[model samples]
Target: MALTPGVLHVTQPVDGGVGAYVAMAAADQARRGWRVAVACPGTGPLAAELDRLGVHRLDWTARRAPGLSDAVQAARLRRIVGEFGPDVVHLHSSKAGLAGRAALRGRVPTLFQPHGWSWLAARGVAAAAALAWERLAARWADRVICVGAGEAALARRHGVPGDLVVVRNGVDLRRFRPAGPRERAEARARHGIAEDTPLAVCVGRVTRQKGQDLLLAAWERVAARDGRARLAVVGDGPLLRALRSRAVPGVHFAGAVADVRSWYAAADVVVLPSRWEGLPLTALEAMATGRPVVACAVSGLTELVTGGVGALVPPGDGAGLAEALLVRLGQPALAAAEGVAAAALADGFGVDGALDGLAGHTLGVVAGVGTGAGEACSSSRLRKTPDERGFDEHCQTPWGQ
Candidate 1:
């Protein structure tokens, strides 16, 4: 008899890194002859990409949290899980994770990937309620997997314990590897930048969590140091108009390009100035593209950007970030060296590592490694009625508790 391949993953738009992580995992699984199905909101680049790779994608969009839309999505997912007959449920994002676990409870083993916890993102009275709700919902999951060690630490801090898998996200080096000088030159020229101009790329959603405003502020400082230094940001969000309006000199918002790989190939440096994150794909792709990263030292950024790959500054320290950017700007040779080191560091985060880690953890969960059939992860933050104040409290610290 042959081993059966059946895996079900739940997520949202699948546009950003969180989405990219699942997409890559499914592709790797497919290569290994696993039957993987991803249930997300609707059709977009993510859905299309999954289709291209022959992974099943269901039409389901679980909203931010506790909305009528979310309720419906959860019901739909419960139905989908029954229909798919999956061996494991890997849920991504807040709403998807909570709802998937709730739906599959007492029947299927669940593994949740908190791409970024909603408990850490929500704030105020509503936030308190949300945090409490997160704790209540956590009881449904068999295991909570954190993509970055920082997030795994946070899971322990929050009380989601036992069998908590720390799986660092991965990148496809083949798709994002460094282009030849000729290839790089053509990409930069197509973007209309001189061959010798200083260029740094910021790739991610334009949101508060991603710290786009901070990048804008940092760009203001970078322009003061070198006017020739051009910053191009890829990806769009609610703040697109506001970010564009507040744009400083030498800043260009590319507005969510289709081929993000090209953006990496066209830059001398890449920056992920997110206020909060969990093994950001932007940094991974940049490193895979062999570009120096000037980023905030939060989440896994410092862990991955070590050894001359680039400079890591304190999360909210604007001056330190500016200084780091200037260091790369003034010394092209240094930036190139950093890029090489970054590529080497990023090589460690390829698809194989992430999938193997995820597979091992999921297998363990299926084998009943930790947490009882109906229990919760370690955390005082776990709640039933939406700990709005607690959620608010966590959200105040940009790093996300």
Candidate 2:
């Protein structure tokens, strides 16, 4: 009468970055012969991918933001946990982080990944409440897996105590590899962009966080300098209507496309004008496609983008963003050279290594080895001294202590 070794991933947002992370982790775990179940909203791209991967799917109705109904969601999650009987429960983002911990209360091995701290995205009263909850509920999660060093630092600065670990985001190299001549031509043709035009593509939701408006402000300057320069903002969100209303002539809103690789292939430069991020997958996708990027110098991005590979400017600085974009578009030869360097660096952060690191951490927790500090809790190839592990130095105290 022993419980089977299984992992259950629970979350609310079933699209975008959190969705991608859940699908990748579940599929990787399933491939390794572990019984994996995902408890999330029963629709969207994430659910479809999980079904394709043959993972057990449990429908959970939860809102993106917290409310009184969280009690209902927590109850539902607890019931799913009972049925699945997993040894480990991985909570993704804030909604699931709250519900999963409340439901499980450390009854099972719990791994909570905030993706980005909730308070960072909130303000005033909501922000204070979020920080308070994170600090108080920190103990409910046995381990906290931060997606970037910036996120980890923010947690410490706000005193969200826990055993923190960093796992930088990565993407699938095979699917997002560099485009050949035929691909470049075909993708441009499909998107109806002239081959000679200098194209800069920004791929992400049209939200304040993604900074589409900031990019638009910069795009005005970029188009003024080079009339043939075109900017495409791909992906839709709550701000889509508002963003489109503010768009200038050279800016095109591509909406949401199934295969983002096609857009990446057609681009001369990829830009992420995010106000904040936990290492955007869009930048990695563009780099993998052998394109240089111009992005804000935010937490997740600072870890990945460097001067040789791409240009990083201060967040919300429209002038700075425009300057960086001009730097890439004005000198095609330099941009192409930087693209080569970007691809080389991006290859080092392939999905395989990330999958392995996740498996090691989850397996360690189930085996009761998670009580030790950081990598000492896991026997995966991810093990290295604190500095060598590439985590923010500020994260040392919580994980080490």
- RMSD after CA superposition, every candidate: 7.2, 3.4
TM-scores, each model vs. reference? 0.87, 0.92
lDDT of 2: 0.82
Off by over 4 Å in 1: 369-401
Q: Top model by lDDT, which number? A: 2
Please give the distance, in angstroms, between residue 131's alpha carbon in candidate 2 and its true position after superposition.
1.1
Which ten contiguous residues of candidate 1 have the minimum total lDDT?
Answer: 376-385
Task: Tell me the spans in candidate 2 whose CA falls farther than 4 Å from its real position.
Answer: 1-4, 371-401
Quote the lDDT for 304 in model 1. Answer: 67
Give a tens-digit lDDT track for model 2, residues 1-401: 12336999998888788888899999888888888899999878888988888888999989887889999999999999998888889999999999998888889889999987888788899989989999988989988887766677677777888887666677899888988668889999999998888899999878888899899998999989989899999998899999899888989999988789989889889999888887678888899999998889887787667768889898889999998998888888988898998898788778887787777778767777654444623221232332224444433333323
Residue 374 lDDT (model 1): 22
